[model samples]
Each structure stands twice: as C-alpha cells, then as structure tokens.
Target: MLTDYHVHCEFSDDSVYPMEDVVRDAIGLGLEEICFTDHVDYGIKVDWDSGEEIRWRNGEPFANVDYPRYFAKIADLQEKYGDRIRIRRGLELGVQSHTIDAYNRLTEKYPLDFAILSIHQVHDQEFWNGEFQEGRTQGEYNEEYYREMLRVVQSFKHYSVLGHMDLIVRYDKAGVYPFEKVKDLITEILKVVIADGKGIELNTSSVRYGLSDTQPSRDILRLYRELGGRIITLGSDSHRPDHLGAHIASSMELLKELGYEAFCTFENGRPVFHPL
Candidate 1:
C-alpha cells in the first residue's frame, strides 16, 4: 500500500495547508495511509516577521504545539475518514538534551500512534538559519551534530523513529559533510536505536532541497541494515500538497536495492511492516 508517514499541515507552524485539505490531496493521489507528524519543538524560539518571540500558554518563548487541540483535531479527522484512509496521529519532536524532561511529560500526556525524534536544533541554535554553524569548522559542526544526536538517542526513548538521521547535512553551509567523518558515531546511534527497538525514517526531502541524496544518505541506510536494524519507514516530509508522496516510489526502490524487503508503519506506538 502507498503510505507517507511524514506529513505536516496547519498544525505545524511552517505549514499552511489545512488538515482537511491535506487529507483530500492525499486521497486524490491514491494514498492508502498517511501519518500527520506535525512539529513540536520545545526550547526553540521562533521569530515573527518583525522578529518578535512566539510565546506559548505559560508565556515561555518556544515553538510547540497545542497538544489538546492537535490531538482533538486528529481524533476528529480519524473518526471522519478512518475508513477512507488510515490517518495516524503523530508528532515530529524537535529534541535537545535539556528538553528531554519536557518531551517526556508531553508524550506521557498524549496518546500518539507514532513519534519522530529529530534534531532540528542543537544547543538551541538552528541549523537551517546558519546559527548552528557560525564560527565552527565543518568538521567541528559535523562532529558536534552527530555527538548531540547520540546523546539524545541514548537518553530519549519516547519516539517511534529518528527522523532524517543525517539532517545536519541538509543545512551545512560549508558544504556536504563527509559521511566518513561521522559514520562511526552514526553507527553507534543506530546501534542504540536498534537495541532499544526504535527505528529510523527515510525522509525524501533531499530532492526537494536539490540534494543528490536522501536525508541519511544511502550509505547510512546500508549501515543500519548491516547493524540488524530492520525497522525503517519512508516519509516525504511534505509541508505542502505538491510535495506529498513525492519520490516515495524511488525511495522504495532504493530500499529494495539495499535488500530491504519491507518498510514500517506505526499504530499506537507499535510498528507494522509492509512489503516494499
């Protein structure tokens, strides 16, 4: 069945597409299932057009979702269209070392089918905006990024999969960070993830960004498989209708070439594998 496990809608601050519209578009594309993995980044400050901090309920300046509303919307959508398409409620949690407690509390409070733990920022510095790489050599940034990922994966256990394992490469201003530089650390992270029964997702946004590789790259996927990490999922990381289900077939073909016979989907935090 065709499924896209990483999608964002109005719930995510960066996405303008409404939930209903996203669903309708997915249906039009003949998708059998899709998971809404909206962003929930704590401790990261977002600036408005005027450069003002976005505050939350407690008046803390951070980017996070309204859990009550998010879950309610997902529940409503599930009830309304569960038969037509399997809508799974999920979150793409932007994790940091210091925010683990907050993330734990949030996850405990909500019932989620799937959760993607991602490092959108390290030490509160966002990679996308070039703040995370300022004054640091490419090697330093790459090492620190993977080290931070290792730290989080070792401590945080609430996620279903690691989203975009090589996400740092997408925003590195210096250029493509060599895989060999951080391969050992990434292997360690994958080992821990596999040991803890967690998995990783193949985010297809690389093509969208004009990159010539997947998020984690084909080498990382091969390494994960070599380490006995069988649990893997495919996601478009689509923030708009046109990007939805993009390049999923090519991703599947790549996985198949790497000897991956199936990909994973989640329901109530449990993984279900489907043939590729």
Candidate 2:
C-alpha cells in the first residue's frame, strides 16, 4: 500500500494547504493512506490559547496546531472518507530538551496514531535561519545538535520515529559535514532508538531541496541495518501539494538495495510493516 507518513496541511504553521484537500489529493494519486503529521514546536511556537501573537513565514502563521479543532476536523473527515482512504491522526513533535514536559502533556492528551520526534530547533534557535549554527564552528554545531538529539531520545518516550535523523545537513550553509565526524554520536542515537523500539524517517524533501542524497543519507541507513535495526519509515515531509509522496517509490527501492525488506506505518503508536 502507498502511504505518506509525514504530511502537513493547514493544521501546520508553515503550510496553508487545507487538510481535506490534502486527503483528496492523496486519493487522486492512488495512495491508500496518508497520515496527517501536523507540526507542534513548543519552544519556537506557542499554543493557540497562550495569548501570544503568532509569527509568520511566507504568509502562514507560525504557531502550534490547534489541538481541539485539528482533531475534530480529522474525525469528521475520517467518517466521511473512511471507505476511500485511511486517514490516520498524527503529529510531528519538534522537540527540544527543555520542552519535554509540554510534549509529555500533549502526548497524554491526544489519541495519536503516530508521532515523529524531530529536532527542528534547539534552545529555541532554528537551524533553517542559521540561528542555531551562528558563531559556532561546523564541527561544534554538528556535535551539539547530535548531543541534543541523543538527550531527547533518552528522555522522550512518546514518539514513533526520529524524523530526518540528520536534518542538520538540510540547512548547513557550510555544506554537508563528513558523516565520520559524528559517526560515534549517530551510532549511539540509533542504538537508543532501536532499543526503545522506535524507527527513523527517510524524508523525501531532501530531493526537492537538491541535496546530494536522502535526508538521513545512504550511510546512515546502512549503519542502522548493520545495527540490526528493523524498523524504517518513508515520508515525503510534504508541506505543499506537489511534494506529497514525492520519490516514495524510489526511496522504497533504495531501501531494498540497502537490504531492507519492509517499511512501516503506524496505528495507535505501534508500527505495522509493509514489504518493500
């Protein structure tokens, strides 16, 4: 079955594509399922009731998803289109070390089918805008990012997968850092992920971003396999319509070339495997 696990629509701060339209587009593309992984970055964005004004990026407001409205809309759509396509409720938790308590409360409150743990920002500094990487040497910034990631995985327990395990490369104006430099830390991070029964995402957005390879890179995938890590998930990381399910088939084929036999989907926070 073709499923896009990392999808964001109007519920997200940076996307204006409406949720229902996203479902319709997925169906038209012959996808069997599409999980709505809307964004909620606690440290960078505020909740709807926080009484703070939202910041915007390209006309879209930067704020956490409206929990009550988001879920209610999903429920209505599920009942309306259950026969046509499987719509799973999910969220991308842009987690940081100090924001664990906020995520803990949100996880306990939502009946999420999946949750992607991503380090979109650390210490409220964004990688995209170079705030997190400012004034630091390439090596220092990379290590610090991975260190925060390791800490997050060790302390956080509510996510289904690690979103874009090496996402730092996406915004590294200094160019891609050598993997060997951070190999030790990545190894530890993957070990903890495997031990906790969590998976790592292969984000297809890397392709649109004109990257040299996949978001996690082929080397990372190979390392995970060598570590006896069995679970992997494919996501387009799509915020716009044209990006949905982009390069998914090719990504699955790439997984097979890397010796992966299956990719996964989630239900009630547990993985369900599908052959590659």
* Tens-digit per-residue lDDT, 1-276, candidate 2: 788999999888878889999999999998898899999999879999889987877777778999999999999999999999999999999999999999999999887999999999988899988999999999999999999999999999999999999999999998999999999999999999999999999899999999998889999999999998888888999989999989999999999999999999998989999998
In terms of TM-score, the best-performing candidate is 2
In Å, residue 189's CA in model 1 sits off its true spot by: 0.5
TM-score of 1: 0.94
Provide TM-scores for the models. Answer: 0.94, 0.98
Taking every candidate in turn, the Cα RMSD to the unseen true structure, in Å, is: 3.8, 1.0
- Expressed as tens digits, the lDDT of each residue in 77-138 for candidate 1 is 88988889999989999999988998898789787899999999899998887999998999
Off by over 4 Å in 2: 56-58
Worst 10 residues of 1 by lDDT: 44-53
